[model samples]
Target: QASLADLDILRRTRRMEYFRIVNWDNMLYPQYEDKMQKTIAPDIWKWLQSEAKRKLAEKPVAHPAVRAHWQSIVDGIVPFGYNVVEE
Candidate 1:
């Protein structure tokens, strides 16, 4: 996961918190301590993001300051999925 704290665009972004869901029914996520299992699900995540986007769009004003910042830095994001490294 990446943090936007240092990004210039996010300076205007609100201090809002959001959530995401990972369907761990199949063990998709890295095994966490037993106490946190079943706490990840995709449906829950989509709902939260949907609400955020809806709230942002409902207001007829400039984006939530952080939106532009996220768009501005989209290309700089690098995926770290595991892959073979050739010598």
Candidate 2:
């Protein structure tokens, strides 16, 4: 029973290696940004971005300043020079 389990594990490992080799160059990603840029006008995109931000800002948070502070940290920049003061 133990030897059978070991053989099963080995077979699975070999199958995984074969799949990795086969899919080495089979990469794919959606060109959503390119498609949106080509289809949507620049001003429309900007308006969409502002609307999304407004929606995000409307969400309830215990500490709005702290929330924005941490979000700016995650974004690695203080967007629009908006200062976030810690409470």
Candidate 3:
């Protein structure tokens, strides 16, 4: 159950990771560069800056499951260097 839930969230947010990686000026795989740049990169710069900050500000709540999931979400964006509250 936990694995499925984690995979689902990863599936949803995988594009965000790609955007971060691409913006890092790294050489992304040639196959994905065209589509990622032409299509996804168009609006991702603006959205990623805002949404990534918002996600980092999110705090885990009282419920264990919710906290765990929230941590997973937070972990995905940790590389982007948002100012997360240290727990």
Question: What's the candidate order when arranged by decreasing lDDT?
Answer: 3, 2, 1
lDDT by residue (25-59, candidate 3, tens digit) is: 33456755543433333244445445544654664
Model 3 CA deviation exceeding 4 Å by range: 1-42, 60-87
Residue runs of model 1 more than 4 Å from their true location after superposition: 1-32, 37-39, 60-87
Clashes in model 1: which pairs? 13-66, 21-41, 22-41
Name the TM-score of candidate 1: 0.29
lDDT of 2 by residue, 1-87 (tens): 996676678678776321111232223535443322213334444444554465457755537785665455445454454333332
Model 2 gets an lDDT of: 0.46
- In candidate 2, what residue range of length 10 has the lowest lDDT sum? 17-26
Candidate 2 or 3, higher TM-score?
2
Query: Which tens-of-lDDT digit does each residue in 12-46 have in candidate 1?
Result: 46443543234456464455544343343444444
RMSD in angstroms, candidate 2?
17.5
lDDT of 2 at 34: 33
Predicted structure 1: clash tally:
3
Model 3: how far residue 18 lies from native, Å? 12
